[model samples]
Target: MGLMALVTLGEWAAKVGRAETAVRNHLAAAPGFPAPKGTRPRTGKGTPYEEYDEAELDEFLKAWEAAHAPARYQVPGDPDEMRTLGAIAKLLGVDGKSVTQYRAAIDEHAAHEDRGARRYYRTGDVVEVLNSRKGFGVALDPTRDRRRTATASEPGS
Candidate 1:
């Protein structure tokens, strides 16, 4: 069989003949959007991605992308620097909890470290998640110079 009707963000963009950024922003702004499954208790932290049922992810994506609306302006890439979950979430057009799920799924491929009470992620890792999940073609070089290499693969670069 061919790819599923609702696959990547790019697929949704293609179906609606609009940019992926637009589709995401619209979903983010839509009323009554489903929040990410699983929550961290105030006393405890770290919700492993495995806590979510696979079907939940499918349902969310299907509903979110079904509209296929175009974006008003281009969504920019994450800055080539360390980013908090909120920053990454804004870039991905999802809530911060959803980003935690994505981070859990691809934790091995990207590097992250906890500083004090908050966990900080490399922008390269966030871009990798966007590229792999959204098919947005964001790139990050496997180099020591994180800042320089990360931006080297952004849209305009």
Candidate 2:
């Protein structure tokens, strides 16, 4: 019979007032049996509890802020520019691989530009690349006066 069957039989025998030695012997002989001593049974410490003192709490907060603080390369006006690969993946409804591909496309484009001019991608380039069709899109290079005019214009309907 199976180990389960043996266990069941052993349980039944114990219930019916069978000798303790006999039930134990039957259980011990069951297939795939391990000695009772082998199991490292879990002790109930329950969930781990953490206590933070004022100094420790302050240090932890500082460390967390430093780790999560926005990098200098991020766009000045766009909060989305602060996103990491995982955050970008979540926002764009895609995985890390897609983000990698987008980065590769940007690198390739930059390489292509380097062949003709000493051009590096700005934040706008990255934005365009992310929203581009097949890694290509119309990029407008605003003149200095045009930028000033655009900035001066008030928001309206």
Candidate 3:
């Protein structure tokens, strides 16, 4: 997992849209689940948590997501796609300030710029950064009152 992203079990739970207990329960029966690569130390005051390889998690998720057409959050066309900070913010459904605050914390951090004077980052890098945070994984717009909750009517129901 050289320089790649490692996220805690909590983040994995968020990624799968399940509670941590659900994840723990599933793990017992699902040997295919990615094993924890290691643990990441807390920045402030908290117990360190089990960290798993993010790429492995993605691979596992892709297979499960196949039947659920049009995922709640669309994966980028290219994981290596270059995007500016504003674009990353939109992708994560977060304010620019929040992303900027965590930008430096991203693993293997680097900033690229084209002649247009805009800073760009790799899509994967941004995801790594977001997964490291305590309050990320779920893209909730703070200013919105209601999230999209209605599923499509079942084929002419």
Candidate 4:
């Protein structure tokens, strides 16, 4: 596989073009289906949030299809597609306003214009903000050069 993915039930269902219940209630109980590797507390109610390795799941599904169904799986690379700020926010589970502000403040990354000149960004850049912890509590001061050395007064200095 070209990417690392620990997918949830919804994602799994989407990958295999099956209903969530079909995957949960039927296929998951099948002998050849892959078992969930981990689980977290559900956000609302119902069953705990179970996660599966997308690569492994795809491999199993591919074989199953060859033996039983009419399809094959194509494991994708890390999601780097360009998307609007709103789309990025939706995908990354962040507030749309926060993404907009962060994007504007960064003043980098030339956006691709599509859908009558709407702006879009690479998914990796947006994901990097979340993973690198550079998007939160960022101070943008016009008076101070961002490259300046941190003073003793700054936090963690």
Best by TM-score: 4
lDDT of 4: 0.57
Clashes of 1: 1
- Name the lDDT value of residue 155 in candidate 2: 14
Report the CA-based lDDT of candidate 3 relative to the real structure.
0.58
Worst 10 residues of 2 by lDDT: 148-157
Cα-based lDDT for every prediction = 0.48, 0.37, 0.58, 0.57
Q: How close is every model to the real structure, measured as TM-score?
A: 0.34, 0.23, 0.35, 0.38
| C-alpha root-mean-square deviation, each candidate | 18.4, 27.7, 17.0, 17.6
Model 3 over residues 1-157: C-alpha lDDT tens digits? 2787877766765566544554566552465788778876765766666688878887876654453332233335576888876787787677777667655554246445564776677777676656544332223332241432322221111
lDDT by residue (tens digit), candidate 1, 19-124 = 4454457553566544444422322354322122334435654665555422322234644567687877787676677657556544666667888987777776
Error of 2 at 127 (Å): 3.8
lDDT score at residue 13, model 2, on the 0-100 scale = 30
* 1-157: candidate 2 lDDT, tens digit per residue: 3222112322333333333244346433544333332222223544322221323323443454455443223333553343444444455555656655556655554222332434334444454555553211111221221322221111110
Kindly give the number of clashing pairs for every candidate.
1, 0, 0, 0
Ranking by lDDT: 3, 4, 1, 2
Show model 1 residue runs off by greater than 4 Å: 1-79, 134-157
Off by over 4 Å in 4: 1-3, 70-157
What local lDDT does model 1 show for residue 137? 22
lDDT accuracy of residue 70 in candidate 2:
31
